[model samples]
Target: MKVKMILPALTEAISPHWRPIKYSLFPPLGLATIAAFFQLDDEIVIQDEHIEAIDLEDEPDLVVIQVYITSAYRAYELADYYRQRGIYVALGGLHVTALPEEASLHADTIFIGPGEDTWPQFLKHWQVGKPEKVYVSRERSLIDLPKIRRDLIKRHLYLVPNSIVVSRGCPHHCDFCYKESFFKGGKSFYTETVDRALEEIAELPGRHLFFLDDHLFGDTRFASGLFDGMKGMGRVWQAAGTVHAVLQPNLLEKAVESGLRSLFIGFETLNSTNLRQQHKYHNLNRDYTEAIRRLHDLGVMINGSFVFGMDEDDETVFDRTVEWAINNGIETATFHILTPYPGTDLYQRMATENRLTSDNWDLYDTRHVVFQPNKMTAEVLEAGYLCAYRDFYRWNAIFQSVSTKNTWEQKLRHLIYAGAWKKFEFLWDLIIRAEQVNKVLPMLESVLDGFGKKSAIAIIA
Candidate 1:
């Protein structure tokens, strides 16, 4: 038997704001993970469209295509092609789970939730016969799962080939969070046993490991045990977590001692009212500035994420958000236009109010305006988003942000890391298109390396 697992290029890839370096940073760990279910004797192929063009000319017994909201159309096109040629096609991922009715139209078998449990079921059915048209996930089991088939990954193609996901979903469901709709049935948040997670870490070959978990600190016991085990691992890592997790006593310390170099925090909106509007209770009343100070004090670089075009946002929101980020000396920032992805409370609310301007999936990339704004027009929102990114990454802005660092090493790291992040896009495009992303890993690691013994004893203040 021959199997082909593909991760189609997501909507962001084709967007005007798309950058090759961003997508080239992580390979499709999801596809490689599910490849674990394939029989050893079966020939397997894994492809990430972000890294390379997919070969639609191939014939395989089973074709598995991971579907994301932006990549839904491309996935459907590929699935239709394979199905027309009498090959079996399976569709699954965040988008498929939320919009199964639409996805079912394109797939011979459509998995309606996380595939950790459903993929094996599909394999069983495929061994004897065709899989059912739909399989909804009713379980959240991450314990002792077969190690992800990392061997199937072309690690050299990705800047962070060591990216991993030890947990699933998040504990707090903001109104706009996709996890709320993705895991509608069973346990929404779960993690692997501490021992198992440590084992995966131990097996990963590198000095840098990125925990791709939505919230690595979701379970205190699991997180502590995992971090304790990693004390001497000599690894520098990164992950995303809520402000609530960062403010938790002792948890942030444990993570730092385990070599957590940078963290992504969703400081979505500054206004507390918008927090209530979006049901982001975790961030409500949390001291955003104090959180930044704590992470800086612990030598953890910050990648603050902000969402714009909320109900309370006005034209000044863009410059205000960017200014706040720079004032706090955030090492990096990600700005979004408050994309209300389908199957979220945000989407339902907008649809109910008849504010959705477009149902075109392509325009839902967050870089585009898909819904009407309250305090400002859609054009104002879109223009503001672009201005935010432009203002934040300017040469002057990088210098301003870097100047806030305490030590020269910290300043240099921020300057190099943040500067190269956006300013060197042309070079990154060249390197990525030429399939030489591996060549740039050492440079990234060097910046991470600067977060060394010095950071442990120093505080920016």
Candidate 2:
């Protein structure tokens, strides 16, 4: 059997947003991981549309496409194009898992859960010419999964080419999260063996890696062992976890010693009531200041994630959240509007109340306000979302956060990263206006040159 596995660009047509920046930022690990599950005898070809254009002319017996909410329309187009050529097409990923019925219109076969469990069954059925319309697997059996087929990846295309996942799913069941819906249950987590994890890391080409877990320290025991094993590797890494997890005794200290240079924390809302309403009760009593202090003290730069448009949020929410992040010395902040994806609890409730403004999957990217909020109009929510980005990432705020806090190494890292995001905010324009990129390069160089000679221990020059 011959296969073509793809990670589609977010739209039917290419744009500056994906072509020049987003594609280079990360490799399509999802497609490559799924490729690992295919039999060795099956000839496999992979293309990440963000990195390269799709080859519709390639004749393969099977084509597997991963779909995300924003990429659904383009994925459907790809599927239709392949099916028209009489090639079998399979669709999976969070978007298709949420709306398998809609996805079935495009794909000859649809996978409803983790592709690790469903893909093999599809292959078995295909061999007999009895391909099922949908294969659903709600099992939580993720141990000893095969390592990703890194050979299939175009490593040089990604900014962070070395990526690995230590775990799958999160324990917390946030109402708006699709993890619970995809896994068919909340409060379940799965991990590969620690030794296997280390082996995968050691084999990768670079010293810097990204552990792609939604919550890296979700299982404390597993994390402890993983950290212990990683301590001797002398590599720098980053991962995401809940605020409460980092506060555990000696866990942060050990992780830092084990090359944990950065963390992506989901501080979804500053309002405690919004946290509770969304069932993220674990953050209820935790001190946000203390959490930031501990992480910064350990030299771990934070990529704080926040969301607006919750039920408790209003016009005041945007400024409050942005100001809180700035005052807290957050290195980088990502803001989003509340997006209730299909098949999640939040979507059901919003649908029942007739609060959903649109069913367009493309608008569900969190950059757009797809649902009506109880406290503000959708137009206001959209405007405020963009405003929050501008407020947090403005040049003045970026300089203050980088210059005034953290160690020199952390400061340099934060400066370069924050500078890149500021450029990204104007990337679409930068493409059309050639002079824009030229103007930003010198500013970025000045920032970097100022800190390059300083000692790592120096907090201020």
Candidate 3:
């Protein structure tokens, strides 16, 4: 059988959220993971529309397209085109799982959740000439699975191609999280065995690994074993974890000892009411400063994440959050406009309250305000969101944030990582366009080494 898998360019190329370096950072590993289920002799090809143009003329035996909210329209058009040609097209991913009924309208079949078990079942029935119209994933497992086809990844095309995901779903579900896209009242959290995770890490050839897991420390035991196993791997890596995880004793030390130089943490709001309102109880009563101090003590440069336009947010929310982050010495920060994704609890509440201003999937990327804000106009929410980024990433703001660091090394690393990442878009765009991202990996690693050199430490008081 001949197969082709495509990840459509998200947010349309012209949308304001579109960033060349963001899309170019990693190849579509999901496609490669699914490709592992196919027969070894089957002809397979994968294309990331962010890296290369789709060949609409190709006629493959099967085509699989991954869809996200921002890429739904592009995915549907491709699905419709291939189906019109009497070709079988399978649609899956977040958007499909969230709105499978709508997705089914464009394809021969739609996968409703993680495709691990469902895809192989589809292959069996397909081989027997009786494939179903829909395949819903009921059992979620990460044990003894087939090797992910990393050989299929185009490493030269990505800046951080060594990305891996050892787990699925986070232990704590925030109201705005996309985990609901896959959960559907089913089990969502699972992890690879520590041995499997370490073995996977050993298979990679680079010194820097990006853990794409929603939360690397979600399973404490699994994380401990994984970190213990990685102690001597000589790797520098980045991953997202919760403030609750950072507050746990020994785990932060183990991760840092295992070469965790950077973390993406969600410090969504400064207000505790917002935490309860969003069911983010893990962050409630936790000293946000203690978490930051611990990570900084271990020399971890943070990419603090904050959401704007929540129920308790007002016109000052953006500036207030940005100022707090700057004062806290957060190396870098990500700001979102608090989108109510279609399948999330946030969406259900908004829908019930008649606050959903638009049902357009494209506007749900968090870069746009898609719902009615309780405290401010949608226009103000959108403007504040943009201003937060501008204010946080400005040269003066970068220098100000670095001052929160205790050591000159930490300060220097903070400035370099945070400034270069957001400020050098032209250089990044050129590097991505030329497909020479691999050339910069060594520089990234050296800079990260500096991030892990903090001279002081702190604990929760």
Candidate 4:
């Protein structure tokens, strides 16, 4: 039987400028791993609609879609389309895991947890013509499942062929985070027994690795052992970790020695109040300048992440954050609007207070505002985000940051990202203007309806 894996984008209409981009740079490592589960008798094809259009003419026996909250809408649309064409559709990933009932409306079957242990059973059931509504695994730890097939790696693009997971689950229970709910009781992680993980990494010809673990250094001993095992492999890798790991000078040096070139750190916010409120690990109260300098001195490029729209944040938060990034010499940073996903604590609290704007999952994309704010109107929050993006990616700011960074490669990456930022500037401006014209102005007018025109204009301004 033929099985096709379809990876849908966050939207169907690809901006003409975004089409030529290659998939390897930010490939869907999750769906690629699932492709390894099928047998030789089954024909497997992978389609990423973000880079190329999906051609349904090459029919398959079954269609599987992997998605996250951002891409949930596109996934549903694809599922509905394929199901109408008589294709058996299956949905998996964080979005479906959090809302199976909502997902089941579009899919014939939805896999709740990790697909490694449940996918084969799903396939077996499908072969017998008895597909179930939901396929779930109670396994709390990462099982020693099959490694991704290296032969399936596409060489034309800048993709990491050898991707592996060293651990799973996080202990940090941040209010605006889904990890807190996904692994509620406690943290859980399972390594691939050092030798096996090393062997898999060694087998890949690309010599570049992408560790999908949410936190690579969640366990210090296991992380150190994994680093030691990777020595002399002539491989360069990148992984996500908490600022606590980055602060450990010795561990940071050891990781550099083991060919670690880039590290993604969840700085979350520059505001100490927001950090303390969220209970984020690492000392947010510490001098961020010193912390960033320490990592840069160790030759590790830091990809800092920040979230906006916390209760403590106000209009000034945007300029303050941009200034922080510029002063710290942060190379690449991702700024996301706060999203309260269904299973997370933030979601429950907002729902209880009746602050949720709508149940439209499509708008749940981190870029949009889905809940009412305590401090500022949604328009101010939205405008702040766009202004921040514009300020950081301005030509002068980009040049200053790139020149300050240590290496030429680092400078080039920053330049490329800055160019991409310029292209998306229009979209960011549209989001800001839309909030002001459609929501903010109308609501303010309603509140000042009885007041004089002069007072209403003053209030708006």
Per-model TM-score, in order, reads 0.96, 0.90, 0.96, 0.83
Worst 10 residues of 1 by lDDT: 452-461
Using lDDT as the yardstick, the better of models 3 and 4 is 3
Highest lDDT among the candidates is held by which one? 3
Worst 10 residues of 4 by lDDT: 443-452
Shift of residue 300 alpha carbon in model 3, Å: 0.6
Stretches of candidate 1 off by over 4 Å are 15-19, 451-461
lDDT at 77, model 2: 94
Estimate, for each residue in 1-461, the C-alpha lDDT of model 3 and write its tens digit: 98989999887454353355777887788899999999999999998888878999998999999999899999999988988998999999999999989999998989998988899999999999999999999998888789999888888988899999999888887889887668675678989999999999999997999999999999999999999999999999999999999999999999999999999999899889999999999999999999999998888889899999889999999888989999999988889989888789999999999999998888888888888999999999999999999999999999988887777777777877887789988888778778798888877887898833432231100
Ten-residue stretch with the least lDDT total in model 2? 435-444
Q: How far out, in Å, is residue 269 in model 1?
A: 0.6
TM-score of 1: 0.96
Per-candidate Cα lDDT values, in order, are 0.88, 0.80, 0.88, 0.70
Which of candidates 2 and 4 is the stronger one according to lDDT?
A: 2
Q: Clashing residue pairs in candidate 3, if any?
A: none
- Per-residue C-alpha lDDT of model 2 across residues 82-112, encoded as one tens digit per residue: 9999999999999888888899999988888
Local lDDT at 1 for model 4: 78
The sequence of per-residue lDDT tens digits that candidate 1 reaches over residues 1-461 is 99999999987785354356888888788888898878889899999988888998898998999998889999999999999999989899998988989998988889887888988888888778766889988978987578789999999999999999988888888998877899889889998888888888999987898889998888988899999999999888999888889999999999999998889999999999999999999898899999999998888889999999899999999998999999899989999998889999999999999999998897888899999999999999999999999999998998999999898888888887898888888888778768889877755766776734545224221
Model 4 per-residue lDDT tens digits across residues 1-461: 78878878764235544332323245566777777778866887777665446877867888999877778988888888889999889998888878878899999999886766678788788778998898876555445667765455443333343456766665455777765554533334545576767777777664456677888887787788889988888667778887777776577777777777667888888777878777774656566677688777766666788888888988888898887887677766777888889887789888998998877877776777898977888888888888887888787787887787766544655554455445554543443333221233222222212222334345334
lDDT order, best first, reads 3, 1, 2, 4
